[model samples]
Target: MAEMSYRTALVTGATSGLGRGLALWLARRGLRVFAAGRRVSQLQALAAEAQAAGATVEPVELDVTATDATLERIRALDGECGGLDLVVANAGVGGVTHAKRLQWERVKAIIDTNVTGAAATLSAVLPQMVERRRGHVVGVSSLAAFRGLAGHGAYSASKAFLATFMESLRVDLSGTGVRVTCIYPGFVKSELTEKNNFPMPFLMETEAAVDRMGNGILRGEGELYFPWQLALPSRLLKVVPNPLFDAAARRFR
Candidate 1:
């Protein structure tokens, strides 16, 4: 894969965790970055840092889950940037709840942020990218998407949707010169993961995950799996018999 510069990358959920890390990493790459998130104060801090680093930073307030507002901000940015070279649909949500007791409202919230929000963000940007015949798009998935987990039923399903969505999108843009990458990162310590009650094996540092994402985006890798331990096993799950895999997975739990 050829390396692409981070000169025109738009990253979502930049207030914290992987989004923040990715925005900063891209800025360090001398990319004209549109750092998007919900927190006004945090975006301000990020702006200061990006400016100090000599990056043209546009900190836009965005709640990807919100329908009208999300699109409005995106439109505003599109006009401001003139054109976009990259869009990382990286906003996501994680929840600890039983599937049976999953509150309809809460589940919708999770779905809206992880699945609908992602789809909306990409859909909004895609026409522009296609019209220009350029741009790279990525969605941040999770190792949890590999298989169902006990408490993360909704979150896992949403991630799985992202993985599948990217596959479908790659086909849709096959000849458009637009690259689509689906990123699955495992056990990165973040506010989202801090609520987990169980142990995370081969857990990687957030910075490492961020770095991995930057490299993958720059190289235009189709599918990225980090922390080889998780990736290797996740691949095996596809071939392992349901009964045997369930038994082993339960033991690990």
Candidate 2:
């Protein structure tokens, strides 16, 4: 494995799924990791599991939806760590909704966490990274962002928002020495994916997915899309004719 470019890191949504996997993986690689999540018990469990494996992971209780508090906590963590070398805005929520019977509450929850919360996580540490002229900011988007899917309109839109938001950051911070990476992952086993009732092509195990993600981050890739079997098709969806795409998407609904 290539040596990680960072020594200190923070991962939000660290209680479960991809966030949890990445947090432990980075710690095992010898980085000082701060794992932040809303669930205290899960956070403690993560810390204990890491410790048992002789890795360092500090658990932090954080609710990313509380934008003000989220910003303050991240800023404090940066100072406590003497400055965070990397921040992974991995916190997000997913939901399935349909246009005909859309529930505002479900849609709102997805936006609140996946968009607003993730944005706050990055925005909190961005200034310090810019001042130091060295740091990596990673956003965990989804292949779903490539095109809006049936029964996943809200979730797809949220990931699309994050992907574009990070892209803009990458362009704006071109020469500031701060690296920005946006990850677009296909279906992977997680609390989120377990709820899917439809078939998921090329579903990846969480560990395998995180390994690819971690390596890409270490290499400072601007954008990382994984499990090419699915990524290729998902990318192609961008150029698919609207009529054909709509016809195919309706089957999933």
- In order of appearance, the predictions have TM-scores of 0.94, 0.97
Candidate 1 ranges beyond 4 A from true positions: 1-6
Q: How far does residue 4 in candidate 2 sit from its true spot (Å)?
A: 7.2
Lowest summed lDDT across 10 adjacent residues in model 1 is found at 1-10
**Alpha-carbon deviation at 36 in model 2, angstroms:** 0.6
Which residue pairs come into collision in candidate 1? none
- Tell me the TM-score of model 1: 0.94
CA lDDT, every prediction? Answer: 0.85, 0.94
Model 2, global lDDT:
0.94
lDDT of 1 at 144: 83
What lDDT tens digits, residue by residue, belong to model 2 across residues 1-253? 2233678999999999999999999999999999999899999999999999999999999999999999999999999889999999999888778898899999999999999999999999999999998999999999999999998899999999999999999999988889999999999999988988889899999999999999999999999998999999999999999999999998766
- TM-score, model 2 to reference: 0.97
Report the number of the highest-TM-score candidate: 2
True-vs-predicted CA distance for residue 220, candidate 1, Å: 0.8
